[model samples]
Target: MSKYKCIIFDCDGVLVDSEPTSIQVLVDIANAYGANIDLDYGMKHFKGSFFVACKQMIADLTQRELPDDLEAIYRVRSFEAFEKKMEAVDGVRDVIGNLNLPFCVASSGPESKIKLNLGLAGLLPFFKGKIFSCYALKKWKPDPAVFLWAAKTMGFKPEECLVVEDSLSGVRAAKAGGFDVFGYTAHDPENELQTLATKTFSKMDDLLALINNEMA
Candidate 1:
């Protein structure tokens, strides 16, 4: 029925609405350090890795070097804040529950952070050991390592998996992994997703329908 036997999901903007939470945390931390950070600026540099983004934000806003231990503090605080306020992106649960194929989460976030956020969002039980983090790989998103690792760990071939992603970086990673990709445009338009996605959808039901047709 379906061309793909496995489904790989991106965690941040895709499965859970963690991006806003992450940005707010970073902004709050930056302000605490006497650097006022803007969301747009954050979106430009902080989409992939938390530390990388944090360091960049520190440098950009303060024009000062970060203490070696600053990121460690930020990490702990971010996780604490995230765990307190994380929610699934609307419709993620319904779509995931409706799917018949094997699926797993692969994220650019740290493994611990991913697990914590997923748990807070109540999606942890569904993923468990199936979660893979790019931070564990040699490189981050837009590099195929994380997705490849996830597919391999789940015993699925790259071509046998479909990646559901919401960000450009995630889409690029899925493409680089040689898998079919569906861009989720929950906040953007299909035209915006066209650059990377083979197909695009804003609604979970629409994506599920397409999956059904593809697998049929």
Candidate 2:
């Protein structure tokens, strides 16, 4: 039997190459509004968060609230960007195709954004009914509620689930839910999740190997 009964994937950076695009859109919007938010700032504060966290971060940094339509604008622009450039993480498709256990996507993104990006990357079918969004759950990462809910709904105990995540907040959430987490470090050169994740890998092929080794 596999070591894990289920695998939970963080959608943006772990499953799809959408982080750079999404971060760029955030930076562009902030800069456009003269908030002076840059890529470094975004990577530090925005990588693992939802819209409410983002709004709070912006307010904390700029001392001003984001426009009410900011999410609407971001959705349109980011969807356009995803349509033109979104792709699944390297080797992720093959990993999913060959996986022996149940898997699902649990992300901080809204359901619409998750569907759009996954569809654009041609990964929608793999996780059609298995997608869990914090927006719909009303419990964001670092809270653990979403992951706990996913585990229950998927009929897996927390210890029987493994989380593949790319953000510190995500790792924290998975850990909080009592699940082992592998931190995907391709986009996190600074190793933010190194101390929290059970293990860290920079490539999907390596992640596959790690998973296999665990099962062995």
Candidate 3:
């Protein structure tokens, strides 16, 4: 059987199908400001990155100073898009329902955003009081703090938890914190997650088996 005692989920792409919606909003807003990026470019470079990171990239792309409210505009627009378009990752509800282990979310999003997205996806109840946000720590992914905090709060060592992540930053953070992470590759266009994660799978339906050591 898999030795994991707890699961740490990344909220955006893993739990709620919000990455594309979120990134699309960023691309649209950035393009309006002359970033000139397409959806594919946003998905590749911005997925899992902090807003500041994406903002700096947009500034670099436009070769000019951006509005101070870039993030504010993004939050408002992205949440609006999410309200209309966000859904739970396919088969995630079933996995969360059937999995017989402890689990929680650790995301780079603000707690309000995480809760809003999860609530929209009908996943809020499963994660109530168990959500950890990097914003809460003023730390972003590739820093390991969020995952470390989640594992500790969930009462598991890093080695005893499996982090389900769909972003490069999330995978890197989990690994750096001494946790095994499964890269969820459903939206991956470049097949990058497989190279960095302990194991990579594309569907949530397969997760129960993967966690239970039923998949070889």
Candidate 4:
């Protein structure tokens, strides 16, 4: 039997290769609004956060309040970028297909953005009704509430669920919620996630093997 009853995935960098593109969009938006931020800075500071957090970070960095429509602008630009560049993480589909346990996406992103990116990457069918968003829960990552909610709603206890995450905040949230977390490190050159995750993997195949081994 699988050790985990369900696998919860963080949508952005884990399932879809959308983090670089999304962070680039954030950098461009911040620059356009007079913030002297770059992709590296944005990725380091904002990789796991949502729009609200991003806005606050920009405000603090630039020492200026963002335009009232900043979030709207970000959504538009991010969707456009995603439409043009989003792709599923290599081999993630195969891993999902081969898994016997149930799985779902729980993300800091709003439901609409999650749906848009997943649909664009053709990973939506795998998740469908299994998508959970912080927007709906009104609690974001690093808070643990969203992860805990996903566990309960999916009919699994915290210890019965495993979280696959690519961000530090996501890993922290999963741990805080009492779930074992596997961190994806393919995109994180800084190795920030490894310390927070129960285990870390650079490839989807490796993650699959780890899961299978754990269950065995």
Candidate 5:
């Protein structure tokens, strides 16, 4: 009895527990560049943003020019960390496995990073060709083009899709793209998503019932 025909999932926090490792890597790199950000700052500003935006913010924060290989460096460190510790979000596999509807992952990362993280987390098999990346179009969340593309390619109108996202940028993207969004709040420490998302849940185990309008 769900209204949506397709589900568009945000990969990092929603599918794989990737934000912490990724943000830690970003923090380490930013610190090396003379920036003073900690993990919390990284999560707040860098979590859902694309590389260009992140780079500009770093420059602003440090007031110093970043190395040309800044992104490359971060990628190397983050991927290594992911390989060692990345895992799917708790109970996510159960929700994904039991869903009767179509689903796909649309992320702010490049296609390669998306695949790597999902693969490392053992969730890639479910996504395969169903993954969509903002890098494909050079547009990231808060722009909404990526989510719109996912819905269109999945053969659903924007209104017929539900976007499950964990970040402010992703939530803004989904809402702007005309989709109903369910905010996964485990990563939402500031409760910023509470007022923005169409619905919100703190646990992945609650998602299946939530999507089907059967949650108690």
Candidate 6:
């Protein structure tokens, strides 16, 4: 049997390469406002939180309050681009499909946003209805409430679950939730995730090996 009965995946960098679409949407809005914002900031602060990034971007460049409709605008544009170009992370399907343990997604994004990205990547069907978003839990990630919620909803305990994540914030969330965590570094350099992760893997085959080993 697998060490854990269930696995929870973070959606963005873990299952899909949606950053390009996200970054482009942010840049498109910045251009509309004639604001000069660095793309690096988008990659860093903006990866997990949609509204936070919108407000921060306005503050960073224009030194002004974010427009009331900016969030809506960004959402619409992001979905448009996401539908066009989001691609599943390499090896995600093979690993997820072959895993013997039950799994679901616990993401820091809004539920609608998570569904959109998953649908775009064609990974939605794999998750069925097991997608849990941070927005529904009354707290966002780096807090662990979302993961805890997923575990509870799945009738599992934190210790009975394994979390696969790609970001420092996500690792912190999984740790806080008291779950075993495997940090994925496929989308980032080892140095980027090593400090936050207990163990890291650059490919899904390696992760499958570890999972199967744990089961064995």
Taking the tens digit of each residue's C-alpha lDDT, what string does model 6 give over 2-49?
Answer: 678998999988888887678767866775676676666666656666
Q: Which stretches of candidate 2 lie over 4 Å from their true place?
A: none
Scored against the true structure, residue 159 in model 2 reaches a CA lDDT of 95
Quality of model 5 by C-alpha lDDT: 0.92
Error of 6 at 191 (Å): 1.7
Ordered list by lDDT, greatest first = 3, 5, 4, 2, 6, 1
Best by lDDT: 3
lDDT of 4 by residue, 78-142 (tens): 88889888899999999999899989999999999999989998999999899999999789988
Alpha carbon lDDT at 170, candidate 4: 92
User: How big is the positional error of residue 90 in model 2, measured in Å on the Cα after superposition?
Assistant: 0.5
The clash count of every prediction, one per candidate, is 2, 0, 0, 0, 0, 0
Error of 6 at 37 (Å): 3.0
| Model 4 lDDT, residue 12, Cα | 94
Q: TM-score of model 6 relative to the true fold?
A: 0.90
Q: Please, what are the lDDT tens digits per residue for candidate 2 over residues 33-78?
A: 6779778889878999887777677767677767888888888998
lDDT scores in order: 0.80, 0.88, 0.92, 0.89, 0.92, 0.81
Q: Which stretch of 10 consecutive residues in model 3 shows the poorest summed lDDT? A: 207-216
The segments of candidate 1 whose C-alpha lies over 4 angstroms from its true place after superposition are 31-35, 57-61, 189-191
**Model 3 per-residue lDDT tens digits across residues 1-216:** 668999999999899989889999999978987888899999999999999999999989989898898888899999899998889989999999998989999999999999999999999999988999999999999999999999999999998899999999999999999999999999886899888999999989998988998332
Which segments of candidate 3 are over 4 A away from where they belong? 214-216
The candidate, 5 or 6, that scores higher on lDDT is 5
Candidates 4 and 5 compared: the better one by lDDT is 5
Alpha carbon lDDT at 65, candidate 5: 89
Minimum summed lDDT over a 10-residue window in model 1 is located at 41-50
Worst 10 residues of 6 by lDDT: 45-54
Ten residues in sequence with the least summed lDDT for candidate 4: 207-216
